[model samples]
Target: MYDNEYFVVDLGNCTTTGEIINNLSLALETLNHTGKSIVLKLNDNYLNQSQLLSIQSLITSYGCSLDTIETTNPETIAIVENMNIFVQKPIEKRVADKYDTQEEINSFQPFSMPKAEEKKDIIALKDVNNLHFEADLDALKRQQESIDISSDLKEAGINPKEDFHTIDYQVSSQYTRPQEVLNEADNFSKSDTAVFVQQNMSKAATMELEKEFENAEKNSIGVYKKAYDENNFQEDSWEEVDFYETATTSPVISDSKSTTYVNQTLRSGQILESEGNVVIIGDCHPGSEIRAIGDITVWGVLSGIAHAGMSGNTNAKIRALKMNAVQLRIGSCYSRRPDGTNIPYILRSSIFTPEEARVVDGEIMLFKINQN
Candidate 1:
């Protein structure tokens, strides 16, 4: 018998960090209905420092406080204490030298701080290799040229780690192995995470290059080639593929069409996003949400947030079989479910009938669909 205000989250045998994050997302969504804080009642589950910190950050962003934490285990108690210390004031403060008393300093005189040590440069040695060259002087000249290039790039704020550090050797001639060039593409830095190959490569080479880019956290891979014999390269010749989603996908579209249909009810924390119009055949729970580019048509009770014209379609509208939405948005206009006292008589009577929300005079207003 908990209070009516607070949203209670029961952590039942869910010890993993992933489970905690998923559950907390749902709990946060549900808390939107009551505008109350969240309470996690731990049942044989413990959260580590990282998990607690993530939870604290999530709730803070939601504009809702983590009200209470109930746990019985001693391990859980220690974790909670760490969370309190993390959230409390005075995270880090510098004290003045004179803040401490002379007597106190004298008592701890033997534990005086050590002097700041001077930093020493470290030199690494590499294995020597003998290679056939035109002349020893030529090798030395190439080494000097590489050094000059590296220094120039560093002065220009272009980190050479992506180029020089990753490359086994520079391709000085056309006879240089393509495999070596492919290998050098693996080296990625914070600034430059991509490699450009001007030479024409085969499909196999392109596939290998894309694989390397995927490992280097690069999304866009550009392969430039001449489109015609005249050397006029159009934008079509510059082939580019977005590798971000193929390696690791973001939120995906469940259905794609002018009118997308959802057969099942949306649970807490479940988000339904559509490129075109959306039609939900089931109820939208309190924590659920639906965002459509065109219109939103709900055949069941709609208690969640519904956004129509998400892609800037100003003529879009939201229609629900039972008009009990927490909030409705049509284009730039939005309206929340009015309180009992504020709800109009016509709107109240059509709660069971079909009700639509549309933008009227730059504001979202509710209207009932006529049966005649």
Candidate 2:
């Protein structure tokens, strides 16, 4: 407030005690003032007695004038008045002369009051901008996310930087010993291939599995065979043997005709020639031929040629579960449907039945199943 005789310091909005100390210190060092009065213009900030004592000491040591302190707030004015510092009024003298005596000023002790000491961690603005002391939470999270697990492993000594040969300690010695590997190789080297396979591949289990598969296949075939026997009762008389065996066997006696049983199906282009009766447990498909000196009985469908009683016994009969023959011969006599050609569409309905064919009055004739 004094014109040009005093140096003025306006600590504009210096909110913190640290900021007030810094501004006041800057003013004391920078300003050109000898014994001239110096004024501190605090807008509304209040300084505690401890801070005021420090400021008073700095002013006294610096030999600067700190007689009149200006503040707008009544609370600040009360604090400055207690400090024994000069307070200027408009067109009037200082208020310290009227309010406080020299003895009271000499006895002023800011330390005598019971006040809590506030500690301020003060850092220069330049130092704050230059140093990275605190970590940003979001930046730290991003950095952690970018860190590689391999690098962490490296830090944990899981994957050492040294070469394998250079490493003296045995980290993997527990997992595998050299003596154990040599013993394993020595034990297996003398064994044959079969022994090696049996020991290493667990071939016993594999063989057991194969036997189980074979048994399952046999059981499935037995089930199908049981079903075939139940439906075609005449197949019980037939033996499950190769068809070629029937053709290659020795010729039977002229008086006694030997019965030959074939269990498998006769496909097209196959021929079964027997010296006596021919019993087929399975189907005789189209284009197959069966020639027997005696009766010919088929347990399944007979869709091919059948020649029975080739030695001229017209009484020999041919029976089947389904008989769709292309031609039926009994004692050298041939019989067929009304149509000359064996068209499956017509023959299926006429001949395909559980019927029998025989020589009736010297003519090959199809007849209904005769139980007698």
Candidates in order have lDDT scores of 0.53, 0.56
Residue 330 of model 1 has an lDDT of 67
lDDT of 1 by residue, 23-142 (tens): 878866754634445566566566776777788778778776675565544355456654552111111124324326634322321111111231111111111211111234356557
> Which residue runs of candidate 1 sit more than 4 Å off their true CA positions?
1-257, 341-351, 370-372
Once superposed on the true structure, which residue ranges of model 2 sit more than 4 Å away at CA? 1-256, 340-352
Residue pairs with colliding backbones in model 1 are: none
TM-score per candidate, in order? 0.29, 0.29
lDDT for model 1 comes to 0.53
Tens digit of per-residue lDDT, candidate 2, span 1-372 = 322355556574798879988888887777645565666767677777787788878877777757667665545555666566654322123633442553443332211111122211222233443223122324545784797677667677776343211212111212321344333443654223223322332322233445454546321100000011122344643555467976788864444336776757798877787666777766788878887767889876788888777655577789987667777777646665423224333223222346788664455555546422
